[model samples]
Target: MRWSLTVLAVMVTTGCTGLELLVYPSDVLRIPEDTLHNLTLSLTFNTTQAFDAALNRSGSVLVVRVVPDEEWKLKIVNTPVQFTAQEVTEAACKTVMVSGYYWGHTRLSFYLTVNHVDDQFLPGVLLRDDVVVVVDRSAKLLDSFFIMGVTLFLICNTVNMGCQLDLKLIWQVLRKPVGPVCGFLSQFAFMPGVGEAPVTGCLHTTSLTISMFQFSYLIGWLIFEDPLQRLGLFTLGCCPGGILSNFITLLFSGDLNLSVTMTFISTLSAMGMMPLWMYTLGTSLTSENNYMKVPFANLAISLVSLTVPTGIGMFIKYKRPRWAEISNRLIKPITVLILVLFGAIGAYSSYKAFLMMNGAMLLAGLIITVAGYAFGAIMSKLCCLKRDKIIAISIETAFQNAGVCFIVLKLSLPTPERYPIMGSKDGHQASSVKFMKNVTFGPIGLRTSLWG
Candidate 1:
């Protein structure tokens, strides 16, 4: 019981350690007058602009009035209306127009100056140039509800789910999975929208991502009695299918060692292969693919991100089995919790973004995205590999590198917050972004299902 308690505490603290909300000043007001200055004015707007400032409107004043969370008005001039604040925030920003105009200073510019609302010197902790404050009363409240509700749901689900996944039993049953699942969602939750999510945006994503990705498949060999530890070509290609595809092959005539070996190879092959695969895939997709530069540097970063730490983890797990057990019991679940939180937050943000965009278009996009997976699956099977090989290759083919795509989007839409955002279905549009979670792709081996 005490060990469980310790594990639980570690999970909560570690999972949330990286979360924060950034507030900033508008472009007009963002320029800090002096390093010693404290008061800063920020702007948030929600209307279309006749002319564009993002293009280069030299003489523009962005005006924002400071009111209590529920009562505030911010005016941005010359930017697209998309709740694009001039400030930077990983979390969502919330804004509403108490009153404004289609033309004039309110529409032409956003201007703000700092003043103490409460006599006391405004604490720097609350204000930073690096991060921007996306304060909206409506967004705050609604987001509060969103956050509180999801958090409670997650907590309940995690506990209940954890209880069912008998660690010992699963460890015994799982034949040393090469890693975790990788598919469109498994592979491309953060990947570009060439395909659709396996599930809807409204999902307990982490729960699904973890269970489905990690242990859904297994790989065993005729040559080796054990279902894992193969350093071969098949494993190179298939280990990514995780346990799901791995075991699915056992039903058919499958070579477990090849898949395992292939997995080891595939995971490492990112050095040369990821670039080659992505480039070839992108070029085939469309002219836009050619236009889109694959950030090989970032891809390299991601490969290192997963490989190094996990290798260390495995080493420790092997060298000190007890410590490995302790760490796995703690780190793996915590990692899952963090990922679940990431998925839920991303889902909420995506949902909020969906609400803001044309509903029909986004839905169409979703359908097309999901359909991409089906297309990939069909293409994989048609290639004429064995059934087991099909599973490995299918996973390899279906999984898109989402983390890379999102990074590209962020790079492209660096200052998108400057646009005027439409009113959102969830009261505060920006609030949904508060937990703009990071996408960590690659294989993640975490426990799922308590003891049903």
Candidate 2:
């Protein structure tokens, strides 16, 4: 009878020793996903006496941790919270902070325990909250700056590129159709094949380029285990040459006329090619392809952006030859300044995204750019094109219109799949830019240019 009575007394004492903490207001918290700074939660004991009991039996410190935690998600800012028995008695409530990293919903549990080694008291996790982290629709400072800078740069640089074009050379090159044909093959055929992206139309003739494309497609099919990786790579390869290519071409003293011409052709063709590839190949990547639109408005804007500035420059060249010459001299320096300015800003703004990228994705981006240059150079040489033409074709082939990819991914994929691909594409865009010193090409000498 004495043993039973003692056992019952111990059991009652053990049950009463567990400390429980309660949250005030509610057990659920709704906060913005962008809350990386801190969020204060009001913590209180389950009963008024619980705090005093904890201090006497457990200790003065309470350790807290988040369950199912990630660095990109909810995390405790500091370690175990410290307190004194007198402080607990005097304070109204205790507060703790948790950081919200990304957009997602999770049931985060705050486990609390005493920081004592005496084993006199046991701690219980009584704080379980349903955290709903919604997306922050607020406009960031860097985003606005990036947009404004890019827009201003594009308008100025495109006009500058147009001033470099020699209409007679463009006409002559078009008439012969050699360099344009090579560029066409490099962009549409060879690149897509290299990326294992499906082409919109079938080629009628058999040639080495065709064989290379098929071979590359075969390689990509066999090698890439993840379909999403193929989709991202293929998307990058399938895009037309961006305006940045023409800027790059001018800096390198490549055939500006050829580069401009090829850029126009590929971009115009992209209206049809982009949709076709997305519809067919996109289905293979994910079923969400059905909901994807062609973004025709963006394509039209691109075309207009390319042509309007160039048209103005061409008029300037025709009517005021002196102004054109002066402008050409000034344009290269301005281009270099713009590149340097944006490169620094971009690096600063995108450091977090870069941190999220894996090493394999970064290495793959480099390989894709290098392979594009190789294909363009080899194909141009095989076609017996001039050095300037070779350089132009290579620049055009290697640089994809990342803006187009951004729109495509944004509109096409769901949020879960979209962000990762977008990040990978951003990494690719950063890697693909091959900055070079201004050099000599044909009659133009850029030895005195800023980069030189």
Per-model TM-score, in order, reads 0.33, 0.67
Query: What C-alpha lDDT, on a 0 to 100 scale, does residue 6 get in candidate 2?
Result: 5
lDDT of 1 at 368: 29
Instruction: Judging by lDDT against the true structure, name the best candidate.
Output: 2
In angstroms, give how far residue 200 of model 1 lies from its true place: 37
Rate residue 321 of model 2 by lDDT: 88
lDDT of 1 by residue, 51-155 (tens): 232124323322233322222222332222122223311123534322221100111122132212212323222211221223211233445565565445444
Candidate 2 residue pairs in backbone clash? none
Candidate 2 lDDT over 94-120, as tens digits, reads 555555443232234555555342245
Evaluate model 2: give its TM-score.
0.67
Q: How close is candidate 1 to the true structure, as a TM-score?
A: 0.33
